[model samples]
Target: MQDKLSKFEKAALLLLMLLAGIFGGLIRYFHLKYGFDALGLAVRGNRHAVILAALFALITLAFAVVIVLALTGRLFPKDAVAVGTIGAPTILLSALSALAAAVGTIVTLASAVKQLSVWGMLNGILFFAAAILTVPVVRKLSVRSDSASPIGTASLIIVFWSCFRLIEVYRTVSSTPSVSVYFYDLAALISLILMFFGCAGYLYGRSGAMRVYLTVAAYLFFGTVSLVGKGGLCLSALFSGAPVAMANVTDVCVYLYGFLFALAVIPTFFAPRRADPVAELIQAAAEPEESGKEEPPVL
Candidate 1:
């Protein structure tokens, strides 16, 4: 039954991902050719090539925030708030990365760094911090068998892996005396370990970390792959005019991949599971009986 549900989830998530990719492709294609000046963004040079970068970032942030909010109770559904406890720090982590990006973009131009290394590295730091900050919430929700654990884990894992380009940034900034190689190395190590634990949790039916790991790992691995490939193309497009077509094509493919990934993930989040309601009820029933028996019988 678990296997059956896993299979169904895989199929459904694939469809969700496929649709997202298709939508991404169409939107990117149009934006690259016509531009998104109305939305306060201009698709010039590599910017056109990386329109999908923003798309991926937006999707990831949205998913992460939603999951974190659900777990921490900041965004609980209906009147469910009084039932369980939620954490505030986790809620803040959910919202901070997006906030950082928005503020960073507004205050600092992308050109502040001569190399994509700096920008990429900063993103990695933000992502890692975001992921680490979420662990408490994910653990909290998961331990309680709440629905939000998988999402929380996934969000953190995704954030952790999505920062892969940080390696490149690390290499780039290695020469600068001010940059701490040790700091980044430590961060990288920590992220990888968390990612592994997250995946392990999922495979073992430890839904708290597993859900997070699966969601995060899928997004991180695929997202980083797509972004790294396209980020390079975007750089090329910025310098050369004729490669615009190639860049747009790359953008489309990335979108398609991302879309397919989403489709695959969403359903896993919903797939039916082997829940033991009877077992749960029995356990609950037994606990009280044991407690009452432990107390002195009515004097």
Candidate 2:
């Protein structure tokens, strides 16, 4: 039985992602900038432990659902899984990330290096190099082959940045790091390692980095929501009179990648599955021979 998703089905899922990702992202950004939760939903009184556990459960369940849907051809035909197509959103995001990273880093480095001292200057340099590494996003507009290097490198930089970014929020529960904060850092580290191998392997002409790229994407998703509703701990403290770090200006690395990859996975992975030619040939040959045989009498 054919089990491919109709356009409407695909649209509905995109809408869900839009609500959960894009709209939810805006709320997080707003809270981070303002240092206050308008909705008053911040977890308090040592309950963050429970919230962290529930958060992982939700993310794990969401990932599993996406996997099952994609693999079973519910999201797209399994036949088309091999030959994926590019979408506009992917291109737009690629362009935006590249430009934002390049321009943001350059501008900030120029303006803030004098005031930033050595550590900030180093961060500015590192971030600038990382930004430059994202060239493939704009130049090639795809993550296949050695081209994955840029994104792989960028993912590593994001992991490095998150280390500094999440330090303030790493609350301790029973002398252990809070699950929400620590888990995200752990995911970023793992993705960084995977992306390194994926990119290195690709350099040797091996394209074993697709899954690694997805992992990075997943980590980015976590990063986008890491500070949501967590007042006073947001990396971006625009309205709270906090001094913004130079790196924060170029943080499009995490935000932009998260948005792009989450959506890009859809078009790059989905297609109308075409029937296997060899299988069709075999079936055709077998069918003719079976048809040549006499039919059994009906009972």
Candidate 3:
């Protein structure tokens, strides 16, 4: 109906959204590697690592609130509070859980190479698998004309966060000399690559006729980033004698950059497009004739 946003306004908003995603990803990445407490939290939890995790949890909650408010004022405004409240908590929890897993993996591995027993390693596998399973379900869900499904979008966010941590696990454990050890890390690394591509395809509007091609491309992009982040971490750790803190930070930098690049697609998906009111009017006029309606008297 009304064009509330000028081209400049639209461009600026798009840029802001992209920045938000990048910053958000960076925040999550840092929370994962260092433990929120280590990042400068005054009150620490035996249960929680840092005040930062709680703070990030709060930030994710805010995103949920804003998205809910927008949806409520627009399409689903009536149920906005309920949806936002219900879904926001999940987002917060998922982010926290992901961070915890990363911290756990790093601490466990760093303590000694032998600490990653069969069960510990298996737990990591399951975490990675849960994320991998989510990819297909997410891509299968129908995105609405105006917005991505809340559930689907949230799942993707979880996938990225978890998969990133899975990469962290690999970076930590691969330093050990055990051959059996490297296999799991290697597999997780490959899995991360696969998931990234799938994410890219779903973002690229590849759900249509060219779905197969798009899926492959999406997976490929994801794989490339996974490889780069992991490979870089490995090479750097080799030279620097990676303390756990620095290793975590290296992981954060790699993921931060990857997410930033991935975020560029967000603008194209949400960008403004041209419309034709005249054609719509002409079509409306012809509809009455086709329905056998007589023209009214001109008087």
Clashes of each: 20, 2, 9
Instruction: Please list the Cα RMSD from the true structure of every candidate, rounded to 1 decimal place.
Output: 14.5, 8.4, 13.8
Candidates in order, TM-scores: namely: 0.32, 0.52, 0.34
Per-residue C-alpha lDDT of model 2 across residues 1-299, encoded as one tens digit per residue: 33344444544554553444333344444433342235433334434344444655676688668756765556654343332435665555555555555665665566457576555455556556555554343222233443445454454564464343233223322244223324544443344344334434543345532443344445444444542332224343546666555334344444443344344444543533335567799999999899899988999
Q: Across residues 166-258, which tens digit of lDDT does each residue of candidate 1 receive?
A: 454456546654222123222323343444455335433454533442344344433433334444446557578744334433232322223
Off by over 4 Å in 3: 1-51, 74-261, 272-293
Error of 1 at 287 (Å): 10
Which of candidates 2 and 3 is the stronger one according to lDDT? 2
Best by TM-score: 2
Give the runs in model 1 whose Cα sits over 4 Å from its true position. 1-21, 26-61, 76-197, 203-266, 276-299
Model 3 Cα lDDT, one tens digit per residue, 130-174: 433343332332232224644445545545554555665676666
Q: Pairing residues by index, what is the TM-score of model 2?
A: 0.52
Best candidate, lDDT-wise?
A: 2
Candidate number with the higher TM-score (1 or 2): 2
Candidate 2 overall Cα lDDT vs. reference?
A: 0.46
